[model samples]
Target: MAQTPQQRRANERFAKNEAAKRGRGSTIKPKQVTKSPVSAGWVVVLAFVVCGGLLLELLRIVPELWTSIAAMLSRLTG
Candidate 1:
């Protein structure tokens, strides 16, 4: 079956597009990942600071725990 002029032009345009797509190589470039500004030494220091804070908090709670235990023991004895 003979196509209309418009249909023929559309088919030609489609084939030309397909050929153009096949003729080209990949134009995409690889993405580069950026490293963090903070170094490993800084990370270690931050971890140490956090751990030191936790240790100090634990130390602060120890005296309260001892007082509570003493109160319980006195109540039990009385």
Candidate 2:
């Protein structure tokens, strides 16, 4: 048995309508409020500490930047 093109089109239209109806009535999520001052301060402090540690580790591996600081000064003087 072969399905006609009209039947397939009807089925596709029905599926689209079903999806749109469900999307409109989807569950709503409550807004998240970061209202804790103590926890927020700790979060900001830890972010800076982690970023600073990674930067130092990169500077250790790429020591040329540290050494180049002296070279740059010498070039300026020369």
Candidate 3:
């Protein structure tokens, strides 16, 4: 459903007022922001560990590809 022009204007005004109120505040409430989709250095390290585990499984299935995978990862990182 779409809002009427007047309804949209009222909402815009409300948002502006809310923003101004937030801007004027010196303390109390923290900023409202979305949590990171993937957060922290440790999370990235964990992701790498999971990927390495998957690759290890793949290497066991296709042992001949280990050298190629190592070279690929080295080239990718470098």
Give the number of the best model, judged by lDDT. 1
Regions more than 4 Å wrong, model 1: 1-17, 69-78
lDDT of all predictions, in order shown?
A: 0.97, 0.90, 0.90
Q: Estimate, for each residue in 1-78, the C-alpha lDDT of model 2 and write its tens digit.
A: 887999999999999999999889778899998677578779989999999999998988788886899899999999
lDDT of 1 by residue, 5-35 (tens): 9999999999999999999986998899989
Taking all chains together, the TM-score of candidate 2 against the true structure is 0.34
Query: TM-score of every model?
Result: 0.55, 0.34, 0.34
Off by over 4 Å in 3: 1-31, 36-38, 64-78
The best candidate by TM-score is 1
Candidates ranked by lDDT:
1, 3, 2
| Weakest lDDT window of 10 consecutive positions for candidate 3 | 58-67
> Residue 65's C-alpha lDDT in candidate 1?
100
